[model samples]
Target: MRLTSSLLGIFLALAALSNLRQASAEVGDDEGVSFFIPSGHDTATNEDVYDLLRCARALRDEGTKSDGASKAVASAIAAAVATLPPIQLAHTDHTLHQVPERARAYLPAAIDLLARIRSFAIAPPCLDRPGIPTTTAGPYKYLIAANLVNCEAIMPYWILEVLRLGLLLSGNSMVLAGFSQNVANAQGSASADGYLPHISVYESGSKDNTVPWLLVAEQLWGAAGMRTFVVVNGSLTRQMVTDPFSGKYHKQHRIQFLASVRNAALEPLYGAPPGTYDNVVFVNDVFFCAADLFRLTHLKADIACGLDFEVWVGHKKGHMSGITQRNFDQRRRRRRLQSSSGASNAADASTADLTLHTSINQMSDVHLDELVRQMAAEGRIRNAPVKIKYNFYDTWVSRDISGKQFVSDVPYISDRRTRDILSKGMPVPVKCCWNGAVIINAAPLVNGLRFRSGISEKGECDSSECSLLCQDYRRVGATRVVVDPSVRVAYVPWSKSFHGSLSVGVGPRVPWSQVQRSGALQELEAIWNDTKRDMATDCIPLGTRSEEADLEKVRSVDLRLVNYTQMFLEDRRQPSQQPTVPRLCNLLMGPYGVVDYGTAFDDLRFAALGKNTITALTYTANSTVNSLQFTYGSGSGNVTATVHGRPFGNHSSVVFQPGEHITHGVVYYDSDGVIKLVLTTNKQRNTTIGGRTFSTNMLESGKIHQAVATPCPNDLAYAGRFRLIAIAGTSDIRIRSISFLWTKIGGKV
Candidate 1:
């Protein structure tokens, strides 16, 4: 419900008069959601405040007849205040309706509950605010209700949220359950620990010792049971194009370069056989622990991101080369709390890189167990209706399902329709999001849903390359995207508690199992509506080389808009349900050289995958092509082993010169499982292949490999031809399934 004036007045008035606030720190207040009830308001006495709070609690608990949450909260407040007519005589316009005759009997029980709530807090909300409830004396389950909004009113609202957590004990059963805990020693997010996750960390031109630290993390993570891939100083800006005629080099567009780097980070997964890793996590330069990755990996969204926070880490003193360090002082830390709720365009993230990355490492320490324990204990998270000290960071890459930027920085996103659901501090649904970090289901990316820059010159939205990735996810029927507020991150490593709460909530909005979804085609159609829609709930142009390009009205999205429009408006029926077009595979089987071996072509991603080149070759032949072992780059380095046909043929290797790459070749095999091989290079040089082979030629399945073509990539070459890049086929002795892998070659005039 829209906040009423009186309710707002109550919030303002109570905040001014509240005695719970401490001098240096805040406790029970969530953003503006205050838990300390005002004992006195305007002229109300100390006794009067308690009585009103008690009455309201009773009314709420009694479930007094009301329409919904907003109405119910209003009714409870009205009923409570109605008792003291002299105090709130001018207020409580909140509910015109009176308390129902059926509900006013449980006032005594509420009074008792109020006494219990005050038992732990020694003083006020800020300093003496409540801490995690412990059951050291015996079994105790506290009645945990949290402020899910930012209204510090006399009639403060509360939601039955778990601080989104319950503490999990390691070996013993003495568990002190809660969400936001400064008292207990945190361990892990119960379910996320133990499983060894292959971690991929990306680092670039940061003015800090990030590379050396990541190298340290590589070893530490392995000790902590994790397979880590650390890319240090692997900046994408060096990917240059040398003009053939001018002999001069050209740099790629910022957006194009960024997309290439992100893809490079996922190179291992993309080239690996299907299902190499369960989840591919991408983390930015933020102060985070292993617990953070474990917790984020456990998130439920197909594309899940953590809520990021900022603390003034540093400043740019000079031109990146010479810089003086900023003192880690209280003043700097306090600046974190000064950020207002506002929108940040992609420009913010671009400029954010200027700040010196925090020197100390944040990735090595916390294990999965520690993070698990922390989330389980903290029954809540930041960014809800609570006062999150750090304003929500990383807004540049996030867009709600309505395709608009997140309107609020904390207390959950203030999107009207999705607010209530998000307020519970769960994994909230969104169209796209990439806060400081993200965990994506590797399957879709493995299939070939890649990040790409926009063709602003061609009337397409020059939005963050990330935006198109989400669209690609939707296009390929992998459309479960969301941002999990439960996983919190900060830029500075000053205060662990100040980093914000960690809890996935007791019950996730989306569970842990996979569910079949036919993508959000309808929602996408609405979001990408180029005409007849409010600009607010539409895609915003970002990543431009010039201000003028950003201002241009986007006429289309994909350069191959015709193909996209075809896919977008393709008969809305599922692959099984559609009756019109024949199965794409049926048409692709022979001409496309689709080898039907054991579990061949089972991975749906292969239908729209990239290419691969032949690496190592080992074939045994008597009458036909027998045993095979071609060590091609399949992301996971799956070496082809002799399964059925094996005579241990003499192995031979093909070594290409520096910059030399395979272009296209023919593999002619017969029914008796025989073959002859012919491989050609991009320089018109064909290696000796013994003979022209026996029979059938597996024609180019080029259409399948080059599905999402980029017609106007910024890094275009005036003259270039396709050469080998990656290959697809079984790692076993399936000689029939060797497909191609191609990428662009040297440029021309």
Candidate 2:
């Protein structure tokens, strides 16, 4: 019910003047909602004010009875107050319509409860003034209600938030019990610990080594009314262990220990104070995340001081990096367990399981085709993308197997045929001809992208022969020396061509030295002598006769040499061998041949170029490829395995690469003959039954090992059952992947 101001005013005025408070306290004084009641205005005396409180309270209790009863109660109160001599009276508005009738009885009870509440109150010089500061035990504004009342108003406004901040600020903590001791310890400890005064009762630990844990504790303790009834949420303990990476001990632990030692050494100078603690602090050693600790803080603060406080031990600047660190270590440890236990062998796995893989070459088609069909039959292909990379040239080359056109403008590619090839029950060797045998001139093209093109020439350079020499230009239809497109595919630039030279054209089909000039040679020799006589002449100038005659004989010999060169050129030639295509087997199966390590579990992330990468083993079936499976567990003990996917009729082994990001599952097989899988992260890890960590370098070569058998609850054909256990002291642990194989004809391996 809503309280009317008139009734509130009567109680407030009466409470202000009543025996429940001195002459200056306020409303509900006896109820522990506030400090000393307002006893009076300046003119009011102690007894005079008591009468007002008594009268107001009576009016409140009478509320509104039946007409006769109400009149009778009101008459009685009026009669009692009227007996006193007239004084300047603060009015109590007694309008019964606004007051609830049920409130009528509480007036007497308030008086009775008043004496009990008085037990908690201190003797006062309390009413100094409004807005005056007060100590924890004083009648200060915030402390007014706090000092007299049970914790109500103070908790909602400030206490809880403070404790939450404290826990985060200070990792160390101490929980003390009871009211009297808590107060005694707070008063004494404040003076003894100077820099880091123990705030007492509640706070989060600060990671800052410089901020003494005591200072935070002192602030928290001092804020409560010098004494609060606190319950033991937990004890302060040193984190004795060191983080291997940091190589540092817990700094807060050392400080706390020293403080405790000092407190023990020094005794309080004053008499026995309220809340003096015995065995007040102790060292605690356990590691838990700040997020986890926050919950504890809330629970504890609510009880102490009636304030709701939240504690977070390792949270800093609103971030929980410590929790994240713990999670990461868990995943790494789990992977280690899978590898050492040989949990990935699929051939030995008994139940149906689906495994995934990344990229596999052409030979993989033999098994992958069946694997996909089996996966589909099991209805497990929820999300798989068909990835395609078109090598245009492969299609170009294979367009016409009949060799109709030796070369086509269109590029050959491994396109539609790729789907067709992979779709078959068996894998086909890739066609190895121009596309596979010849290496495309990619280097020059790449270089061209980087290089700036030279400026184009305006005109061709002058040259006598266009065919023989690379003249700067050539006429249309003029045969010129150039690289052939077909030959360019097989050759790098600046190498020897199919035939030696572009030109072979110094032939005059001479019928055996026709015009073998003996006489013309003599006459011509004489003229040659005359011609040689004039050398270095713009206009023909003749040299001296003796030197001229010798030059003439040399000139005649030079002409004879030029005449015999054409005859030798016509006599030389060699036949060139024709080109042929290469066989398919040599190209499809690489130099050492391909090994299909059957599919392990994967998300097919390998298909994407610039995303999370996937690495796994590729498996191919030699004969009728059949069933595949694997198992895994979370702990080193016997793991419960469950199978997924459909079993094939032919034998197949599950393959997986250990260090890859995606292929994590149970050890390929469990004794139950089911494929097991688990979840794991960085913080909580799996160790081998012997406790060995898995390292990346050790898995260079693959191993297909045997699995140890354990009992199954029931004979199961698929992922029928599994087990999970709670870690004793930690919150980090899970499983990731598994691999194994089961064959029908063979005894279990």
Report, for every candidate in turn, its global Cα lDDT versus the true structure: 0.36, 0.20
Clashing residue pairs in all predictions, respectively, total 54, 116
Residue lDDT tens for model 2, 688-734: 21112333443232221122211121234312222111110000001
Q: What's the lDDT for candidate 1?
A: 0.36
For candidate 2, what is the lDDT?
Answer: 0.20
Q: What lDDT tens digits, residue by residue, belong to model 1 across residues 502-609?
A: 232212222212111322233323333432122222355653445322423433233234333223222111111111323221111121122222112111122122
List where candidate 2 sits over 4 angstroms from the true fold: 1-99, 128-749
Say what the RMSD of model 2 is: 45.1
Q: Estimate each model's TM-score.
A: 0.41, 0.14
Candidate 2: worst 10 consecutive residues by lDDT? 725-734
Model 2, residue 353: what's the lDDT?
Answer: 28
